[model samples]
Target: MNLMTLYDDVINEDCSMIVPETLNTPHLVLRYFRPEDAERVAELAGDIHIASGVLNIPHPYTIDDARDWIGQHRFLRDHGEEIIYAITVRESAILAGAISLRVNTEHAHAEMGYWIGRPYQGYGYATEAAGSMLELGFRGLSLHRIYARHLSWNTTSSGVLTRIGMVHEGVMRGHASKWGVFHDVHWYSIMDDEYYSSSVHADHPGRDPSGV
Candidate 1:
């Protein structure tokens, strides 16, 4: 069993917005994972394309595995160690993916990670959920930095990180091993200042990025 801690409330300017809720997008919604979601999560996470791209997702995903994963997440978030959300669709209610922020309360930073199912590849759901998490990290958690990393060979992951405004911070050569081989990793991040300034500018009626 993966043991986890419960919440220790962190102060944020928009503390009220820190509550758990679903975030909607054109084709999907980011929400909490339920026990019933284990089977579907296993299905989506079982594929080599999805599992191999990630650090810990096993290729032959099982119901027990999924259950344990979600259980660990619930425990961790409840203890305030991290926050995670399931990426699902409103119409189908299928588990399409996941997004999470592993917090470093002392450093006021969190690392973001995600993976989309093989069938949903090429769509923009990854970036969409990523944007939502970034919003939560900066606006709700009041975090100072959010960083992400990917295997150097994974162009798709690199694209998602770059598209979200994180710069290539460099590589960690042979720093990690997966699938019987060592791999290099690319790091990227966004600072709190950038998020805050962008938010203020977007809220100004005349200068709104959405241009309502």
Candidate 2:
């Protein structure tokens, strides 16, 4: 059997836990959000550099806004709609970013999304965390496909998507409005078989170190 079928067997046997407790890469840990994380979330996500690139964040992202956002994660997870993680360093345990997968169970796919704090942007944390998230979606949740999108001008995000083995699909012109400006969105995706066949996945040294 190929890697994809092998993963299906492994997940069916020992991976009985529904939602993973934590997901780990060589350098990062993707854990469930905590109430105490609001301060750091606000501090990192509130930056103009981060907020401006994504369509959802608003200017002056307040602590209340972070709390409210974090608050919804559990509800969403409990309902099997999404899984949101706080991305942190494995050694330092410092918050580096956030990553999430919005599941569409009926369609057997999930939409991946992520952002790194300005301080952590250059360290490859986004790519590392996102790769682990993809593993979680495919192997852990048995998702058939995982996809992500970025603003056309956000080449950094595009690079992260590519680094994680997603295939660039196409662009949606004027697909979203961010900070009162409309922007084209470039989409990317990877199917389970495609991921298993990828060089990145074939030699993925990180391998969700926590095995979640």
Q: For residues 23-126, could you state the per-residue lDDT of candidate 2 as single tens digits?
A: 87778878988999999999999999989887788889999999999999877876667889999888778887899988876676889988888867677678
Instruction: Extract clashing residue pairs from model 1.
Output: 5-79, 6-78, 6-79, 7-78, 7-79
**Candidate 1 residue runs with Cα over 4 Å from true position:** 1-18, 198-212
Q: What does candidate 1's lDDT look like per residue over 112-156, in tens digits?
A: 999988766666778777877787777667678999999878999
Q: Number of the top candidate by TM-score?
A: 2
Candidate 2 residue runs with Cα over 4 Å from true position? 1-17, 202-212
